[model samples]
Structure formats: C-alpha cells, structure tokens
Target: MSGFSPEWLALREPADHAAINAQVRLELVRVLAGKASPKVVDLGCGAGSNLRGLSPWLPAGQSWTLVDYDQRLLDAAQARVARSPLSPSPREGGGTSVTYRQADFSAGDFAPLIAGADLVTAAALFDLVSVPVIGKLADAVTANRQIFCTVLTYDGIASFLPEHPLDRAMREAFNRHQQTDKGFGPAAGPNATEALAQAFTSRGYRVIRAKSPWVLDQTFERLRRELDQGWANAVRETGAVPVREIEGWIAHRLAAQDAVTVVGHEDLLAVPV
Candidate 1:
C-alpha cells in the first residue's frame, strides 16, 4: 500500500527475479541450508512478489512471513501465494508455509522475532526508508546473527534510449522526489543501499553488494512505457521541469526502436557473525 499499484508490482516482478545476483543467492542458500526450518520475514512485501521469486531458491520446509502496511496487498499476496507453486502450507507440496501480516515497519510494529528473523528479506523497500530505521534493522539482525538479503534497491541510475535532451532533468527530479518521505522520514532514495550496507557492516555483519539494474528492450513494451510515464509523473511532482517539456520528452520517448532503459538497482546480501 505504499502507493504502488498491483499492476506495477506485477509488471516489475519478472525483472526483479532476473536481477537477483547468482553468487549472492548461492551464499545465502549455503548459510541457511543448515537451518532445520528457516524462517524468513519479508518487510514491505508488496503483493508477495519477493516470495514468488525467492521461495523456489529456499528449502521446502521453510516458513515465510510477509509484512506490509497495505491490507489489500496482503490479501492479494495470500491469494496469489495460494495459487503459486509456493502454497501456504507445506502439505501442498510447496515445502513452504506462507503467512501475511498487516504491519507498519516504519513504526517498528514487529516483535523481536520478526526483527531477528532467520533471514530478513526485502525487495524494492530500503530506498523508501530512512537511515535510522535501517540502523534498527541492523541491530536486530546482528543480535540474532541472521542473514539479510535485500534486492532491487534503486541506485539513482537511469537511461532512456534515443535519449531526450531532458533526460538528466527528469532523472534528477525523480530522484529528489524519491527522497521525499514515503511515511519514513527523509528517505535515502537512491542512497539507501550504501547507508544500509554501512550500518550492517559497522554492526559486525559481513556484507556483499551487487548490481541488479533493469535492462528493458522493445519486447517489454508495456513495462517500458509505464517506467517512462512513472518518471514523467514524478518529475512533474517535483516541479523540476516545465509541463510543456515534460510532455514533449515523454511523447518522444514513447516512440522509439530498440527502446532500452537501464534503471540501476543494487542487491545486498549480509550475514551477521
């Protein structure tokens, strides 16, 4: 319910799954392989896309808790999980039991167990949070010696093929709008990965960072258009560009061959000692 539409989440899910770092995933799997039944808590889980993407990578007898502020998304996540190969109960051969909770992570509504979950997972979330919140997350994960795997955190990198003259302005304005408080105070936006990594590392956790940029070509026409429109809306929100230029830029970008967009994101895999 972070103002992100279900359509948008669905549109981006495939790209997110592909963006996960192979080496980082292997390291995380190795670390959790020893747990009899690993417990993973996904903060800010929207529509359960993270579960859909990562559950296959985990052991069958694991438990996953999906937390989000939006009840509607939670409902959708539960319903979708039921339909997915990762069913709610292990009895369904999913080898995983899924649970959903309506909670506000920014308000710190979770108990110690969630904070120190065996594996703390988040996707497309850190960028919307503040430094202090990330510090608190680090403290809890360190306290329980847990593994933290967060992916697709926006890193302020974007490019539009058949580049427009206003690309730079659009990106800068969008990034600035990203920094605006999305419930969390003064979001780190594109800067979240670095700040979160430093927080975890400073707390004695070993961390690895990997690039997970989204590379889109003409085949992904709808997703590409949405991304472009999303940026235009954000830039307009920031009042960084004139309305006429914004419309012109968006119109021009909408029609192009081999239209490719690389939106930069990073993944962090940290294991507390």
Candidate 2:
C-alpha cells in the first residue's frame, strides 16, 4: 500500500473529521452500545486520525489495535493520541487503551488482525483497493460478525467554482489515474463505496451509506492549495492532457479569490443482521 506522510495526514485531518457522516456514526454507536468495551482494529490508520475522530463517541474502556504499513506513522499516532484527553491513563479506569501494529494487509493475511475485533474500521482507504480485497474483507467480517465502518472514500466527483475550460479534462484524467494500482491490485477508485456496499449486502449484512463530501471554501485555503497540486500531479501521470493545460488549471484555481472545491466522498456502516 502507498504510504502517507504525517504532515499530509495532519493537513487533511480537520476536513476529514468534518466530512464524516453523523448519521453513520450514530448507527455505529447503536450497534456497539451494549458492549462494555469494544475492540476496534483500524486499517491504514495513518497517524490515527480516524481514532481521534471516532473515539469520543465510543464507550469508555475501548481498546484499539491501530494497523499501518508505516511504523513511523504508528509511532506518530501513539504520541498524538497519548497527548489527547481521550487517552487517559488506564489507572484512571475506563480510559481507552491503544496498541499499534505494523502490518501490510496487501501482502499479508487480514484474518489475524481482525480476529477478535468487535469493529473493523478504516478511513480514506477502500478507494485504493480492488473489489476482491473488499469481498475478502466482507467475508471475514461476516464470519466474525463484526461491525464494519469506513469513511472518506472518494467517489470521483470534484467540482470547482469559477470553473476553468480544462476542468472536465483534468477531472477525467485524475479519476483515471486513481484506478492505477497503489500497491494493491487495480483500485476500484470512485466505485469503491458501491463495491463495498454490494460486498456486504450480498452476504446478508445490512449496509448503510451516506455522502461525506469535502466542501472547501476560503477558510480551507491550505487544504485547497494542496489538493490543487495533488490533482495536477495525478492528471500529469495519465498524460491525457497537455502539461501546459494542467499547469494553467492549477494556477487559475490557486489564484481565484472566491474559489470553492467540493470533492465527493462516502461513508459506509455495515452490521451483521
């Protein structure tokens, strides 16, 4: 799997937290309500943004096994979480406990990581993986009767205000590049949410999905700038558009004072019926 730097993850964390679907989270709260302590395994944890976002809603005394390919990120996650109010010392009683594990599910078995988890959760991950991998995940979750929740999966919709002539072309090229392998097989990309929903539903699990789009305005200037550069890079990789046009589009987007960028994403909550 591709690695994400802590700085990049940090920059996007606020938007990611804001974009999470409240309804899906409410449903998850209901699903795990009765458990005294929920064991959650977070895939591609990446500095533990998902944990920091969702931990407060969960029951106290929760235990988390944060799994990531990068040990540096795991270390970062631990340090950050330790500083948060959420990670109170265990002696305080009912405080959350966390452990980090370095593992690459793309090249290793997933069953062990999820073996005893009550909930298997990930954020900003499914879109980068293949359908078969999702299916296998559904199978394991079903077998263990674990609740599955994933958020911030890109769905191929990106719109910018004060639209440029090359907007459509840039978006098309970027979406195509998204399907390229990110260490997994060919990615599902924009179709990931639908694929994940179908995978769980076909196994008789109840799946709920909701829109979780990033709506960035002037207040998110830094994130918008980063996104502009990232999209330009991805579009360049496809070679479907001229380099000059891509550069122009990025320049126009960054320079626009009243710019707004909305990137569509979806969140899913699957529960065993």
What does the lDDT come to for candidate 2?
0.90
Query: For candidate 2, which ten residues in a row score worst on lDDT?
Result: 84-93
Q: Which residue pairs in model 2 clash with each other?
A: none
The TM-score between candidate 1 and the true structure equals 0.94
Tens digit of per-residue lDDT, candidate 1, span 65-125: 9988898889888878777656433422447888888788785444554854688999999
lDDT of candidates 1 onward, in order:
0.84, 0.90
Instruction: Please list the residue runs of candidate 2 whose C-alpha ends up more than 4 Å from where it truly belongs after superposition.
Output: 85-93
Which candidate comes out best when scored by TM-score? 2
Clashes of each: 1, 0
lDDT digits (tens) for residues 1-273 of candidate 2? 345889999999999999999999999999888887889999999999999899888877899999999999998899997786575423324888889999988843688999999999999999998888888888888988899999999999999998999988988898999899987789999999999999999999999999999998887889988988999998998999999989899899989998999999999999999
Clashing pairs in 1: 60-95
The per-prediction CA RMSD against the true structure, in angstroms, equals 2.4, 2.1
Q: What is the TM-score of each candidate against the true structure?
A: 0.94, 0.96
